[model samples]
Target: MDFKLTDEQVKLRKEFYDVCKDLEKRKPHGFAGLESIYDTDEGWEYHLYCAREYAKKGWISIGWPPEYGGKGTIGDKVFFAEARGYYDLPGIDIFGPEMLAPTLLGVGNEELNKRFLPGIASGEVQWCELWSEPNAGSDLASLTTSAVRKGNEYIINGQKIWSTGAHRAHWAFALVRTDPHAPKKQMGITFILFDMRTPGVTVKPLYYMDRAHVYNEVFLDDVHVPVENVVGQENEGWRVTQLLAGFERSSLGAIMMMLRQLEELVRYCNETKVGGKLLAHDPLIRNRLAQMACEIEALRCLGYRIADAQERNEMAGFEASGVHILASELQERLSWLGADILGPYGQVKRSRWSPFDGWYEKWYQQSFVLFIAMGTNEIQRNIISWYGLGLPRMK
Candidate 1:
């Protein structure tokens, strides 16, 4: 359980940082967050450009098997993520390499792997998750979206809500009901993938309060998907769903983003004077900043622990939930602190008067998304209690 990076890992870490730093310099002004890839034409092009750059280095498949274009270990993947987070770079699609690739490696058949892995590794295809339905978010097993087999294809008809970047995705991995007669709701479910451009598929914008089009409502009306697109086995998608969830929650990128923001805030406080005194000199500000630093460090350590577990091929299950809860809550706190530090200017966005290009303003408005996305913090707590603490589930 040594936390130190080996000499080679240290060199690889430096390489990641050096490349990301150069990329950061070329980033368009106002380029922030994954939503940028979907909200503006320039942003989307820039995202694709960065993706190609990383793909050329074989970085998108860093943690995959060598046959699939992968050449690095899981630890290398972690370092790359940290570098991207610290620099606020966006090239890797979280739905693709971060979640689906590993899941495919673990459960997909040879045909499925050979067909899809190459596209993802090459960064030639982007993906979205169509998991949540209007009435089936937290209780996803209750989803009623059906995919009935018809010859060699499954005819899909349903709706998916809160699908992030759906309008920009080339393909989507989704959960659907393939069997209505199964004894349990979870038993009837299936995991499948299909092209977004498939006939009968439609995507509509679901704008944020700030009018950002980062999410969408995706509709399927007899969308034809090849039966071969199914991941793992039909009528047992809940297990696949659970497996992907582990990767989703084990992300360390957000934590590194917070660290960068914290560093920026510290610099601002040290240089800016308020009431004829440095903000850093204010005891109250110092106390809050110090507290956030410590919390962020704790989360970083926890992330490393989870990554270590993953390297050992162990199920991080509840540990991933723990990281999710802490990281999301910490972000909320950090955003609030930023707003407080900036006062009224914090509320401004994309304006000359706003500080830090109003990044904090937008962040404060959207920080609550993580509380509900992927899964709710309340649900995460239940996972921690039930799995980590060995507590009984209340019937």
Candidate 2:
């Protein structure tokens, strides 16, 4: 593949970067991590403002089908992601555009698509995932959340833990057990969407170590959802779940964020001296940084390949898992390296002595989340082994 961009793509890239750079200038102080969107009112308002700006430009719908208001190709989507990642912008809601929209485009009924796509494209609707439960995170098939059909609606009941941004989400896409008696555990699951303000739904915060309110525990007690809200066939949501999982894995935005952070770290090393020696001149630091740069570049290439495959409507099953593993582990490694370079200063959070406005400290605490989120790295490795390597399952 020729890595060079076309003339049109080059122009689009420049426009995306220019707009994001301007937005970056106006962003709130300490708006560093994804959690900031839900952790504070200022961050949340900034996120809404950015989303509205992107919506007006049709940036949020760039990758959608033209009939659904999309006006660009997958490459355009990649460029937009790169811009957002580099600038650490939060206009786009990951659960909505990044995950659910593509899945809906692939498997949803015509009515569902027509009804939901506009809300997402306009950036008026924010979404959250309600998949993980206290007992069914990694082994998601074991989830006990129930959704029983009753005429034109389904009654849902159960709890979902570790739901990111649930407290602020306008809607949610979730998996529930529609048939507990199916012969196989995964066979009985169903995918459904519902309003967050449903009478029986409740959301409570699960504050992080940094006291950030990004994650939540959502409880559904006899919540009612229309049967038409079910995506694909009932009891076959596992297929939809797997399809959405592919979209969740290739995180180009995250790779871009790490790239920006890497550049900042390099600048710090060049300008800051320790014990009369420039940190950049240290052989060990230079070697580590070089290795990280190589890994990040390779991951970026992998991301581009995935986007190309998606453009062609091909499924990148094991390759998506590979991206997930590399991206998550690379982030963890990069954060560890940042902590090492910053030493004692890295531990300080939002204080006068903290470097990069305490970004490294927050990053160090949150880097571990990617490993566990969107399926654990250990599970991703098993996927690579089974699908990529054609290895037999271990019973």
Candidate 3:
């Protein structure tokens, strides 16, 4: 594929970078890691501020269709994502724009998009995902979050764990079992959306080993959700879920963030002294950084390919898992390399002694999240082999 950018695309990307870099200067001091942006009230406020700023620029939904408040091409969406990652800005949740909006466009009625898309496009409503559970995270088909129909509404009662940003979200999209007695687990699932303020809904914060509060466990106790809120047919939610999952796995935002971290790591190596010389002069560190740069470029190109695929409107395929696996595992490896470079300073957190103000430390702590989130790396490999490569289907 030709990677050349047109003049208009170049201009758009530069404008996005300028705006995001300016926003970076305005963000709170201690905001570095992705979770740090949502872990505190100050951080959350900064996120909302950045979100509103980006919304004013109309940069949130550049890839959405023209009729749905989107005015830019898919290439523009890459610039927007790069801006977010370069600045570590918040307010862009995958559940809403990147994940749900695409699925809704594919299968939702006009009323659904008219009501929900506008809020998401404008960043008026933030969304959380409710797919993982205590026992059925990677094996989401076995999820037992049951939603029993009652007239015009469904009474949802179950628990969802590892729900990122649920504590701060105004809304959520979830997979619940609509037919408990179905012959197959995947056959009975239903995709539903509801207000986070529903009567029986409860969100409790779960901290990382480092004491961050970006993830939560959500309990739905008889939460009433109108049938109208279902994304597609009630018992046919699995198909809609598959559609959204494809979009979710196609995200390359984290890869851009890794690129940013790499820049910082290289700068650190240049300035920090070891054995009477800068770390950058060390042959071992130089080799490691070179290898990381190659991997990051590979992932970035994969991102470009996926974005190009989305541009063509032929995205209902199995390539997303392959992209997701390579990108997610690269995060872990990058963090590990950073940790090795920092030595004891890498383990330090928010301390005067920590290197790079404990950013690498926080990065190492949270990078493992990618492995588990959006399906485990093992699960993604299975999807790639069976769905994409067509090697074999699990019985």
Candidate 4:
């Protein structure tokens, strides 16, 4: 299917690009660095300030739908196009708006949607996903967190790990067991949102090998969430989570961010001398760069194809999984190449105010976290196997 955009769609994309043109000028921090600095409360506040500036500059989508605090606008093709372009520029994490917005628009209650959607759209409220735990990382249905009914409130008590951006988030949309005795593990859970400030909630930082606190361990003890916080029907959070995961994987790769990394890699190779000759001139290094360039083109086109399918409201399970697998592998290879090219200098943390702020150096150590987070490559393969190849489960 040729997923070409119309003239108006193209124009809208240009407008978004125009607004995002100065992204690089805004800040040096991208996904990898942003999380690294989110340890202190003040750091999170600074992050929020930057996000608010983006929103105020019309870089966000606040006037989306009245139900979810948006203007009730319908623009999927434009959204996907804008998202891919947004990342090319200096972009804050758009996961909350991109992943959760559609789900809320599709299934959230009018009141619940109105209250949370506007803030989310305006960058006033940040969100995190509390789906995975230590035991139930890949096999999410095996989650043991329970939320028993207590009058109009459901008392939640459990642990959630790898909650990206949870340390500074205002709220979280999580899955919990409402009917543990149900026949299938996937059948008895519900999707719910909770305020981070609620009592009985604790967020502990989880630092990566690179010395950045990008992830967290959240403990919810006797937390009380109102019944109104639940999204869709009871015992159906599994389905909601599946849908969201599909959204996550579908957005695996876009040309913008990868292209930025590629440009940096090329420069590093040209300046750094190996055997007194530029690394870029070396045949082996050239070949690797060529291979990565080809792979990036393939990933870019593949993302457009997936976006087209999603725009049509198609069942995107398999297509999304395929994209995830490709992007994850490509990222790993590129990260390894970057570290190799940087040599000893890649391990150092350059002073930001001094000079060449060592982005490549930091990226080398930090990029590995991407593969393990956001659904591991191993889990992506399992999804493709079960859904795409019709493989039988392990006995």
Every model's TM-score: 0.97, 0.97, 0.95, 0.86
Q: What is the TM-score (0 to 1) of candidate 2?
A: 0.97
Model 3 misplaced stretches (Cα beyond 4 Å):
248-251, 314-316
Candidate 1 residues lying further than 4 Å off, grouped into runs, are: 248-250
lDDT of 1 by residue, 100-182 (tens): 88889989588889999999888889999999999999899999999999999999999999999998989999999999999
After superposing all C-alphas onto the true structure, candidate 3 shows an RMSD in angstroms of 1.7
Q: Residues 54-118, candidate 2: write the lDDT tens digits.
A: 99999998878888998998888888999999999998888898888988998958899999999
The alpha-carbon RMSD values of the candidates against the true structure, listed in the order shown, are: 1.2, 1.3, 1.7, 3.4
Q: Model 4: number of clashes?
A: 8
Pairs clashing within candidate 3: none
What lDDT score goes with residue 88 in model 3? Answer: 72
Local error of candidate 2 at 250, Å?
4.9
Worst 10 residues of 3 by lDDT: 244-253
Tell how far residue 128 is off in model 2, in angstroms. Answer: 0.5
Top-lDDT structure, candidate number? 2
* CA lDDT of every candidate: 0.89, 0.90, 0.84, 0.70
Model 4 clashing residue pairs (backbone): 23-90, 63-71, 64-70, 64-71, 64-72, 65-70, 65-71, 65-72
Give the C-alpha miss distance for residue 242 in model 4, angstroms: 2.3
The parts of candidate 4 lying over 4 Å away from their true place are 1-7, 28-37, 40-46, 57-59, 62-95, 248-254, 351-356
Better of 2 and 4 by TM-score: 2
